[model samples]
Target: MAIHKLDIGEFDEIDYSLIAIHTSLEDYRLAYFINQKLHVNLNKSKKEIQITVKEGEAHFSRFHYYEMKKDVSWDLIQNKNEVIQQQNENNQSLFSNVNIEVATKVYMLPEFKKVDYFLKIENSENDLNIVKLQNTLNTIDNIATIYLVDTNKIKSKNNLIF
Candidate 1:
């Protein structure tokens, strides 16, 4: 597995936050569902097949999809049933705070090879709360995994488990 670290200096003046979604499904399906469920219009990329929610986007690749699928399955098998149940309950509550009307954007980096889906929120005057956005995504049914990583906190971590 490869790990990538973020350079804090590059994002010092940026007031945006990133959310990553790891899944084994097609990006278009996921993007469309999210748009319908969240009531947002995610723009499509003409260069490559990608969907962006505002500036936040989702990409599809066979390699990453299979890798993430395997990892998610392994995680589920290793966890206890009760623990999973409790987490689901907590997620339900966590998603309650999400503001559906918040302006959100998605971007997918071509260098990542469609494996990583980055969600960018313009946090102008705290218009979009990172915590709430994270919670909302955590409850989504199809997403295999979701992460909220701050620019300052980026480091060599096992974010992508294949």
Candidate 2:
């Protein structure tokens, strides 16, 4: 991103997005980063980064990430759910006062009766508060029973297994 001073006789400011040149890292994956640094290697990339998209290719350190908001974080997450808790801390984005967590929580719900991928949220400015309550939840995906909870009040119950 960039900022510029407007020069139409009066002093003003303008902001711009600076696009980074998509480049190849051309390096080996640091095992330490994947392990200790919480970096996930989905697969072995032939190159560190790929500017061009391809089929069945793994671009190293590439994350299909999401940003979790404060309301949703409090609503959905339970205490000490390890994967979510860690992601909430490390990969949080800073736009609003939200805990932007990242994790791929794939579930097999018999009630919802399907498989689904759980990406926390897209961005901070987003407002997505509708979650399917398991007992009353109805979805074609059948595995989409994500609920909103009252953590402090200890209101907890769901049909599916975590």
Candidate 3:
């Protein structure tokens, strides 16, 4: 695979509180490649750039990425709260017995204290659900920017620009 280098200028404006990367390859491969190419050491431990690789995706976070994931349980807590909030605000059922769950993993870059998150929504067909997930996740403190990357696009383009 061809390696694409990201420009330093591009990162100047980025806030590392929360970010996401979608890649075609496994999270480990992407993280390893990024570390090698960018000359940065990102590891799962040390809280520098907490890296989590799962199911061909990865996340980077400045804090305990996995701990946060554990804390945000999509199946039981977060989704339930979102559903209740949505229903109360709309005064009607939006999901209507449908399971609304969002699967997300986070990653971070210690050098910049920036984070990247991987999001997968169970009801991806519903645009409203997607928006709600994004909005809810954004509420997490210290999150400055969010980047949604399509792995297929990255594979075809041979680079991750942002």
Candidate 4:
């Protein structure tokens, strides 16, 4: 098997679109080969990028990894409570109080490139749910989100600070 190298940026996140092979290649062999060459680790979650080496198809994909770039404003984060308050202010029925927790300072959106592991589930943002929140944030740049480490309901987290 021959390996080709591409110009992967220092912080560029990987997605399926980065896969360049257009031909119908054997997926298993392809994945194994890529995994062997790339030293791709397999036992990661949907929140991790790895080559999925299966029966007949070998492929690399973002799978479940989330990448966040740091460019967040202090105003957005410090005033998060206010923002939530304002957002939930009008729609008392929707964004109103439920449960909110503050993570450690490190979990707060970083000012530079890094991974955030905690979240302070906002009182108002609970209705949309974490999965929905993740889907919504995926479209925006600079501002990106991930699932809470464990709890599904109130664990929405922004990976990057923006």
Prediction 1 TM-score vs. true: 0.43
Candidate 2 regions with alpha-carbon error over 4 angstroms: 1-64, 67-126, 131-138, 154-162
Best-first order by lDDT: 1, 3, 4, 2
* Candidate RMSDs in order: 19.2, 21.9, 19.9, 21.9
Q: Residue by residue across 15-52, what tens digits does model 4's lDDT show? A: 11111121122333333433443333222233321122
User: What is the Å distance of residue 53 in model 4 from its true position?
Assistant: 43
TM-score, candidate 3, is 0.25
How large an RMSD does model 1 have? Answer: 19.2
Against the true structure, whose lDDT is highest? 1
Q: Which stretches of candidate 4 lie over 4 Å from their true place?
A: 1-119, 124-126, 143-145, 151-162
Scored by TM-score, the top model is 1
- What is the TM-score of each predicted model, taking all chains together? 0.43, 0.18, 0.25, 0.20
Q: What ranking of all candidate models by TM-score puts the best one first?
A: 1, 3, 4, 2
Model 3: per-residue Cα lDDT over 122-161, one tens digit each: 2223223444444554544344543554433332121122
Candidate lDDT scores, in order, read 0.43, 0.25, 0.32, 0.28
Which structure is stronger by lDDT: 1 or 3? 1
Q: Any idea how many clashes model 3 has?
A: 12
